[model samples]
Target: MRIALIYPPPWKIAAREETVSYGHDGPPPGHRPQDLDADFYQTPYGLFTLGAEALRAGHRVKVLNLSAYAWSRVEEVIAGLDADVFGMSCWTANRRGVALTARCIREHHPKAHIVVGGPHATPLATEMLEHHPEIDTVSLGESDATFLELLGRLELGKPTSGIAGTVYREGDAIRKGPERRAIHDLDTLASPHTYFDTHIVMTSRGCPWACTFCGAETTWGRGFRGHSVRYVLDALERVLARLPVKMLQIKDDTFTTNKKRVLELCHGIRERGLQFFWSCDTRVDLLTEPLLREMRLAGCQRLSLGVESGSQAILDAIDKKITPDEILESTEMAKRVGIKVRYYMMLGNRGETRHTFQETLDFLDRARPHEYIFSCLSIYPGTRDFHDAEAAGFVDREVFFTETFQELKTPFDASEEDTHRMNEWFFANSGLRIVHRDGVADYRAILERLGDYHAAHMDLGAALYHAGDLEGAEHHVRRALELGYPLPGLVHNHLACIAHARGDLDGMMNHFSHAAKVDPQHFVLIQNVNAARAWFKQGGPGRKLPLQLTVRHDFQLLERTVQPTLPGPLPEDWKAWNAIALPAEPSATYLRTPDVEGSQHVLKTRTRLKVVV
Candidate 1:
């Protein structure tokens, strides 16, 4: 059987003047805020899982990420592709794209089986089928097993209507199958990491907590389930080897739900000599000093906590059973072990008010985490917030289909005045915030807890250099290399800075040259190297200029030169599809989507850097 999986764009996008070529060597240039505000570019991880399953069953699978492609290009690609089963991963932001792509596929391949499954499609399966005649089936919830079964039945020319965990059209009426039980033994499923090269990895499914703003429970059922420690370790080993950068985001709903499992996994990482910096998201209440210490030793770089709001009343209203104190204590603990603490703050929840809004800002000041990001409450289809809104007549199921917003980013039950104030604040104060930086003492404490760790040595060295202890900094930086720090370019970059401080012009350039050759892909390293090149181009040390250096263990890598590729047949019109030229200028309705309100920010970004497709 021939299977095609697609990740659609958020909306119909007109091509821009400048061309941004996709490459397989690395991701396109880092996302500029205005051009790529939402995370729509990332191909949904589920598609890889489904593709892996199909491949194991001896079926050919082709996966394409058309998330940022222009509408014309998308149409061209869709028209060129032929498959028996066409699967798409839908989300609230990309619902419009899913429909558009489905229609394209239906027109191109009249007999192809179009299946849509995702958070958005799962909750509104019946509506999706009723409104969009192009989609043949909607797989609800965790769909690995459901998808494979559907494929088998389709291959044998059997009816797909009776498959569990699916809703399909039958004689002009939509019929839903029986509820599918969640997979108890996750190890039974093939690991997507074995076949795909993606920085995103989810070792667990479902969050035990029923936060009203979250739709996780709806997506993965009520309780939490995780792959066994060994399974996760094996997956990690495989994924890390394939990734260009050893940094990964373990995008679980609640990564540390089972503290014991995480601890054992952390220990296994060190024992197996798996050296990589990684980040995970979890609740504050789930973290502990010991677990954090072990995690840092095993190369845990950052811990992101979902601290939605600071007001206890607001927290209770949203059913977030955690206190502000817990958030603070967890921040301190993670910071103590040299793990960067990032808080995911939210605005305009159930009981949000001007006072409560101020409380959140005050709490941020008090907590002083390493980083924080704020987002407005978006009422999705399967969340309690959505149900409550529907009941109160604030919104209906049709809004998701009709409205053009990337997400319904609005205040839940807040006064018009309060909503106005919150919107004003949010517009001014959105995006990531680096609130704090670890000092020498902080990194020293980390070294104490995690003895002889390469990352710790490098971190301490950077801190020392920043604190103007050049000699002490040099020693630790050299020790990091001796301990086999994975990113030696960072080490040499630091050495270059130290050389500059000591008036060794030749040594500084030598070190800089080495950093550029070895680690030219990292964004920070690229910036610094460019600065050095410009400096030398202008004049030598005789110019008497103070060279500014970016001295930090920024764990970010360069974006992929191209999108992820799978082992499958190329599109029939691959050459023509790649040759399609973008319009020199956008049309009047280019930014018609509500998510993209204005073109000013986008224009600003475009003039500065090439937009990554």
Candidate 2:
């Protein structure tokens, strides 16, 4: 069977000037600036897992990342696709897009089966089926085994109903089957890194705590389950080999939930000689000084903490289970070990007052994390906030089907006065705020903990260069290059700046040329190269003036080569396999089945189809 898994855009984005052909023989898509949201444009990692599962079973699969495509391009791609089943990832931010895309698929291929699943669809499966007839089935929660089984049933012309972890439409009634058990052993499933070259990797699933605004517990169940250290290291090695820039985001719910497991994983990474910079999200309370040091030595460049609120009252109300003191201590400890600390702050939760708001701001000033980003509370389905709001009649399920908002982003139970104040402050300081810069002393402390590591040496060298220690900076920067630092362009760019500091124009030009030749994909190197070209074009060599240089390494890489991360081309007789009967055995070890037959409550409402032009 031919399966197409799509990552839909949040909404219909307007066209932009940039265009690129996305592994299709047609006119390229107009890449819009709105599609550049790092959070939204990133193809969800689950689709890759599903594609791998299908391909392993000798099926043809196409994983298309239409997350950044304009509406016209999405239509063209959807129309061109020839598949028996269509799988789409739905999130609170892109719920409408999922519906729109499902409708488009039904219009083009009336017989194709449509399946939707994600954090949003897992909880609101029945409502989704009732509102949008375009969606045929909704796969609920950790759907690796469930998805493969459903595909087998579809191929054999079997009913989608009576399958574990699925709710399907049969005529006019929506029937849900038995609840699918959580996969006891994650390693039993195929690893996504084996097939796709994505920078995102999840080493674990589920969080122990149920933060009010989060739906992690809803999707990943009540406890944390991590992949074995060996499994993770293997995934890392495979992904690292394919990436041009050896940087990854370990996107787990709570990465450091198992401190011992993390320590062992870190040791394994070092033992295997896997060199890459990574960042992970975790709670501040789960961290310790020793663990932070070990993680930094193992190439943990940044640690993002879910410090929802700095006010103890607000934290307690949200069941955050951590005090403001813990947040401060964790931030200081991570900074002490040279790991850049980024706090994920929130604007509004259960209880919000003027005093509490002020407390958050004051706490931020005291904590002084390297970076912080704040977002308003969004009441997602299956979350504590969502259920509580529904029971209190504060929000109706119909709002999700009616409201055009990207997310239900509103202050939960905040007073009107407090809401106004928070919104004003949020709009003013919403994006990532870089509050702290590492000085020479800070870098020295970092280097002491992570000795001779390429990244640490480069960071300390940059700090030394800024502090006017040209000789010391040159020695460390050269040392970093000798240690086989991945991005030599950054090292040579630093050398160019150092030479420019002195009166060595020839050395500066030579270093810049070497940087451009080695790795011109980094934005910083590109900026310096463009500046040099313009300067020489204007006869800078003959002028008696100093050329200004910008020396910075933000670890951002421009993707020069775009390899299509999809399954190989199918054989001519591949479709004939679908007609062959095959047993659908459970892939992973099952824990237990829950009662999810659910009340047959169907909402008699029409879904409003609106696309933002």
Candidate 3:
């Protein structure tokens, strides 16, 4: 059978890609930038693994990366393919997008079998079949074998009764098959790389850590599992031989979960002289200077660390073992050794407060890793955090459905006003400026108290730019400069935008020159050159100012506080802003209308929003 694997695009946030879903409230307060790109939406690994299994079984296969392409484009890519099966992976965050995509596929190809898989569908298979009629079957956990069996049945026009790990709709009722056992001998499965032209490999499955907010423990269990070192090494050798793979992403929940095993893997890679750059996700506490140095020697170029919080209390609340001190030491060590670090921090956990929130800011001062990711704590179903929130009275039990979980209202440890204030505070002082603060005086006060007004200004400027408020963007940019915010290469580019908008040719040229001088290797400079050429061609001003500016701030403070330091690099384009054409009127409106007495209750009572933006 011919098959098309689909991945849905993330939600749009100020033109950036963000994960938005019906089951959880949007990202935690002040966590992610409005413009985070869609880099994370790569090909779905599960589908690739399943597809490889199918192809090995002699079926024709094609992949449609809907995450990279829109629904219309995905159709175009698969237009001529005579595929009998369509498989889709949907996470809670991308379920809406998946559902919409499924409907479109049904309309375009009514006779094709539609199958759904992934974490969101695993536990809620029945609900998915009942609610979404377009989806013919839902594959439970570990879909490779299950998908193959289902396809085999489809090929022979046989009943799906005996298939394991599948929930199929029989007339109006859903019939679930036997629970599929996870493949223990992972080596027997075909390498996921076979399905794609590129190289990718997984060293392990499951994570040892049980962070309250994470779904890993709930989805894959707390027991860490891995293929033998020899299996992993052989897979690497095969990939290196067949594909021009410049980098290897160790697609593990936590690569350092087994320190001894990771050390052995690194040594093996070194001994083989793989000469490939690699990246992996790890916790800060697990990393040591020696391990980082060893990994660096093995061509490890990037490490994404989940430094969930700077507040010790919040860390404890979420069962995150590392302290603020550990975060500081590990990040500093990583920086010292020359490995690029991406810090993933979580905001808006239960028990969060103004004072504890400040602890995070203080922690940021010392742990200062390269790129800071501020994400809201999402209470995914079956996680400890979800239960904790529900037990603590934060979750509205009535709307918590077994299938298609929903968050009725934004749960807060403080009032909505206080929650919003804390969010603004986090954005202003967390070494990353990516929040909107029009009338958030308390948050601004906290920034001022922390000596971060300059950083706050840069953040506000970026927020305005993203919001398409050009005048406001200019005002904040000037304020950032006046407050003596460090103007990195990206900052200079932002200034050039302002100068261009104001028609100050000399100022634009000067700022652009400064930007080039500071970060000659900046990617924005390429765009600058292109814009200059375009302006000259149009016989217009040699440079036009940008309608908005992007801001970058120092995050080096995190390094000083954490321990057993690891070395790492920061993200490129430290700061950036471009000239955007503003809409004739505000494209989106947010209301701060007065709350009616029973309105809050009613709003809190509703399980799911009729329309999710």
Stretches of model 3 off by over 4 angstroms after superposition: 10-37, 68-71, 74-81, 198-200, 238-245, 388-414, 426-613
Tens digits of per-residue lDDT for model 1 on 1-613? 8788898877676568635443321122333335344345667888988888888887777677787777778888788776788999999878988998899899999999999999999999999999899999999999999999999999999989888999999988999999999999999888888777778899999999999999998789999999999999999999988766678888899999999999999999989988788889999999899999998888788888999898999989999999999988899899888898888888878888889999999988999998777777778999999898788776678867755555666677677777778767776767677799888888898788778888888999988998999999999999999987877777888898898888887898898788778765455565677787788788855788767778767654334433443112234444332221111121222212222321111111112222122
List runs of model 2 lying over 4 Å from the truth.
16-37, 543-548, 555-613
Q: What lDDT, from 0 to 1, does candidate 2 have? A: 0.78
Q: Give the 10-residue window scoring lowest on summed lDDT in candidate 1.
A: 598-607
Ranking by lDDT: 1, 2, 3
Say which prediction, candidate 1 or candidate 2, comes out ahead on lDDT.
Answer: 1
TM-score of each prediction: 0.89, 0.88, 0.65
User: Could you say which candidate leads in TM-score?
Assistant: 1
In candidate 1, list every pair of residues with a backbone clash: 23-561, 23-562, 26-560, 26-561, 27-559, 27-560, 27-561, 28-560
Query: Tell me, what's the RMSD of every candidate?
Result: 7.7, 9.1, 13.8
Residue by residue across 1-613, what tens digits does model 2's lDDT show? 8888888866665457646432322221332232223455557888888887888887777676666557777887788777899999899878888988998999999999999999999999999999999999999988899999989998899877788888988788999989888999998888877777778899999998988888998788999998999999999999998676777889999999999999999999889988777889999999999999889878788898999888999999999999999999999999888888888888768887778989999999999999887777777989999999788766777777766655666667777767777877765666667899889998888788777787788888999999999999998899989987767888999999999888787898899899878766565676677787788788887885446778986544234323222112222343233422111221222111111111111111112222222
Instruction: Please give the CA lDDT of all the candidate structures.
Output: 0.79, 0.78, 0.59
**1-613, model 3: which lDDT tens digit per residue?**
6676666543212213523342332232333332222223445567767777887898766554445333344444445445588888877656655666677678778899999988767766777777679999988767788888888888999977657888998887789888777777887888755445333467787887788777775456557888777778877877666433244567688888888888898899868766555778888879888898777666565677888778878888888888878877887676555566777766667667667767776776666565665655555656676676667654633333322322223433544554666556544534333221233343244235334344455555655655656687677677766754433555566667666666676887788787677554334443575576566577664344333332332221111110001101111321111111101121121111111001111111112223231
Please state the error at residue 284 of candidate 3 in Å.
2.4
